[model samples]
Target: MKVLLGISSSIAVFKSIDILRGLLKEGVEVQCVMTKNSAHLISPLTLEIISGKRVIIDLFEKRERSDILHIEITKDADLLLVAPATANIIAKFANGIADDALSTIFLASRSPVLIAPAMHTQMYLHPVTQKNIEKLKSIGVEFIGPYEGELASGERGIGRMAEPEEIVEKAVRMIMKKTLKGKKFLVTAGPTYERIDPVRIITNPSSGKMGYALAEEILRRGGDVILISGPTHLQPPIGADIIMVESTEEMKNEVIKNLEKVDAVIMASAPADFKPKISLSQKAKKESIQYLELERTPDILEEIKERKGKKLVVGFSAETSDVVENAKKKMISKGMDVVVANDVSKKGIGFGSDLNEVIIIDREERILSTGIKRKKEIAKIILDFIEKKLSN
Candidate 1:
């Protein structure tokens, strides 16, 4: 992978060295480009020595190539990354102000663009800056973070550059081969809530991390995603068509509604198995309700079985015992193409955890066990399996 790293004037320019090193560690060829003002903060010589290529500082710098320098740099780049991007550079890129080498490259680059903004909190929050960021986003430019933390001004607020590791990871995702390109997927996430009253409801402890990770991986692989998510604090992945639902019925309806448009269905949500048979119109007093009647919620998988028409259906089985056995049974009973079974009973994984260990079983009884891996890693494995199956 080749990444064109653009560095603009900012006090956070020092962090760009780490970003360069990280990308190099990933075996990515990085060509460094710096705004004129940034050269004062970090030496071009230092970047040249590390990247083993002369850094481009001047727009008119003489080169051996007959082609335009800025245009040539972007032609073979897989991604254009700006770490510690100053507000000035951002505005320049947003408004077609390309008087400098870095900004000129931004105008000429046709590859995926990833920006990590770093500026004063107040300047970053200004309406003009926000509008510029939105304009870039609307055109599919990705942003990592201007997270809340100690800033260059010594005031705590947003505008801190994301860690170098995070930026490199995002860049890698952007440059990954689009194996899932031109495919549409429906992914269900989180735990559904069954309302008992205006003030109370029944739900599970699922944090939705697994499902959200899956959606992100799918998007990274260039798939169009319809994410039917239950209530969770996690932000929806950029580029996904997000649908929020509270009850099992709502989730089912939305899934079925969009089922025909998707090439696959990844049912990652943990919907409430039962709901109050007769919910009270108002909040019931402690003494007013001695017992609560319950009934089974709608079965989304079963309902879609007849309507799916050969669409790949991937189901999840969160079990306490007989994990693989139960998942195999569910896969067969629901006509699922594959089933991911994980023992929620285990500690440090599953439910609200970021890590998971799953046994993936397919219709052919092929089983693969992923021993204790991050949910993000597991999501990639699942997607890789799905991609291979679809290609077959």
Candidate 2:
């Protein structure tokens, strides 16, 4: 397979050479492309010698073109991997602003684009950078880790590029999964409501950040997404099959109906445990007397898990106390192969916020991971873990 090894302006650009060497060792052809600043950190001569191809810096460089349109490497190659992708480049690609040679090729390419962003923790966590990363994934851009480790800023945080070996492995797996081409996924997201009146409803302010991130990741990993969402002010994740519902009962029935199909069911929605006995059409008037009946909602996640013959079932449990204990209970009760548990009491993290701290308690009650990170990054970890499990 032909690969476009694009390098962005980051100190970590030096790592791309190892990635190129590994790919070439696998007998894959590689053409190196570096941003103007990247060339200063890592010499173009080193890449040319390593890949056995002249590095392309200027888009219109006087290089001979074969019948293969080298300009549209995205169209000709099996994959395009951009290591040490910087925030500037990520934003340029997100808004379709192509101001440089690297950006131009990205715009012209139709091949799968994989980006590994590297920068300071502050820059990586900045709202603008976060939004750009979100937008890129919305358009089918894959990501490897900006892992938690040392950084050029003389501090340790989450802005390190993924190890070269891991990046290559993920790239290969992603390219191979295109064989499941045209395969689609049916995913549910957000917290559901059980209305008591037009104005007042029983719903969790779950934020729906994680589920939305998962839906976006599904699109990036090359699967069609049918996202059944509950009523939330949050915008529906783009590149998904959006079906909006207002009540737990509505979400429950939808899950049962869509269960027979799809490659996987990521039951990330926090459907209300008990809904109001009566759903009033009009807003309720304030009164001194207040009493209402409640009833259990359908167990959508468990029902689907039981009925799922060969499909994947993933569930989420957000606990305020006894995080591990409650998560384990839910994993068994819900019959979920994988359960994501997190404490939502911490400020600036989990529920209604952009970040989350989570632990993956498998069916065996084994803790998979625990830490605070952006929901998008966490979603990638969970999705990659599940993909590995499915492969085994």
Best by TM-score: 1
Compared with the true structure, all predictions reach lDDT values of 0.92, 0.81
Cα misplacement distance, residue 127 of candidate 1 (Å): 17
Overlapping backbone residue pairs in candidate 1 total 0
**In lDDT terms, how accurate is model 2?**
0.81
Report the Cα lDDT for candidate 1.
0.92
> Model 1, 229-288: lDDT tens per residue?
999999788779999999999999999899999999999999999999987788888788
